[model samples]
Target: MLVRPSLTPQGAALALAQWWELAGLEIPDLSKVRGGNPETGLTASTIVQSQEPNLTPARLVQGSHHPQVALVQAHRLAAACTSMDALYKALDAFEGCRLKANARTTVFADGRQGASIMVIGDVPGREDDEAGKPFLGPAGGLLDKMLGSIGLYRATNCYMTNLVPWRPPGDRSPTAEEIALCRPFVVRHIELAAPKAILMVGGLTGQTLLNSTDGIMKLRSQTLDYRLGLDAQGASTYAQCVFAPTYLLNRPIEKAAAWQDLKRFAQKISAMGIAI
Candidate 1:
């Protein structure tokens, strides 16, 4: 919600100058602020010279710091990767995750830019590690069928990626430690893509994405909202998480339930008025 305050032209300009200075921005022309403060009948420039408030480091960072400094740095780095190419480069160069050591490739992301639908998988398996793309093996083939049922495909209509970009060793699920280490990259990915909707391909990805411990069977029934907190561009994302296609593949019988989930996701996409 936006609150629009009414102010006089000079008052607005004064406010603008103050805001610019507060934001550490330079304002070359300050004729408006030099005029005078509406509150005190004193010139703003004179006030700055004489009565400028001392800004201490403690005052600057007064509150709202996250508990973990490492995660904060991760968020900062993720915000820096404004473009997909930048994200790929950073993720490839990242040596933070232990999974990166043995992994043959860094599976960053695949599919079209500006894609409305984004699909997220857990981590790369053997073939995916070799190929350096998310969801391109047997699991990916199964995923294609699942999406095709709902009239979606990566080549034309979907954006596919994974939570843990580097393949986990022995085809095992990534540990919580590993997932936490790489989470910022994925969050930035979602913000950059700004996808209208998202699909989680397996339980590991589903749980990690939502920051939950629940299994897919229980989570699948609920309407899950994945909130990617504000990005550097001042844009935040609230995305819907759909059921995992790999689960559908494992238990073909559950595909019926998954189908219902897909239908719901399709309805949501249609309501958004997205083309695909």
Candidate 2:
């Protein structure tokens, strides 16, 4: 296996800046990393590129077709990937999302792949961009605590992923066009994981997946019908949307209300006899 050195706090920040330049994302905070934390900035030295012959960076850069269409094609080819291995395989060949062209490695989902409780977020941030994994920065740390309060942990009982596989430029909210471009892959991910319960964490994820224009406050604290299949042949998957950790971190005062929502989630799962 090819191993890469881990980056220090300062080094990660510099690398993130470089990635932003290359990927055409804005520099949200030139001095800080995503999640708005200053301590130990985002790291990128640890990222490892895929060695697959067909998925090289050159191939991604040289492709003439729109990146979004390439991604859609990749998902279609993947067709019903039911596990992380299959999902990774599909993503490796994907050349959509310009972020992939500039990133050192693809930041895919990390955690228990077969867990009963699945959490879906918006996309990878700067720290996640460097680490090549979702939810590893300050917001992720907060998410850990929130999950712990509900007796669920990513390593043991929850599978985590995002709506878009690649980080957006400059940590911006993905555009409607961008979300629509990547929608199919996320749908495939849901089908593969087949989680008993899903927690859509934030307005972006909730709105994109649930097809709602309502804000997070209006969307939170309720169970919504979530579908996870094609129109002609898909299953009626059910899930609930809640305030994303990033939102809670920004507005700490709202945490109490967020906790109430989480408690309800815990109660629902407990009643179903699903392992927490």
- Predicted model with the maximum lDDT: 2
**TM-score of candidate 1 on Cα atoms, chains taken together:** 0.70
Clashes of each: 0, 0
Candidate 1 on 224-276: residue-level lDDT in tens?
55554542335433244555555566778877777787788777778878778
TM-scores for candidates 1 onward, in order: 0.70, 0.72
lDDT tens digits, residue span 1-276, model 2 = 111112323343454355555789654444433323336542221111121224333453234134322433443444546566877766755665555665666777888978888899988888888887888889999998998999888888898888877787777777654665466667678778888788888888887777667888888856765655545344554476778788888899999998998898888878768887
* Lowest-sum lDDT 10-residue window in model 1: 60-69
| Candidate 2 TM-score, C-alpha based | 0.72
lDDT of 1 at 126: 80
Query: What's model 1's lDDT at 41?
Result: 61
Give the C-alpha miss distance for residue 29 in model 1, angstroms.
Answer: 48
Model 1, stretches more than 4 Å misplaced? 1-73, 231-238
Candidate 1: give the clashing pairs.
none
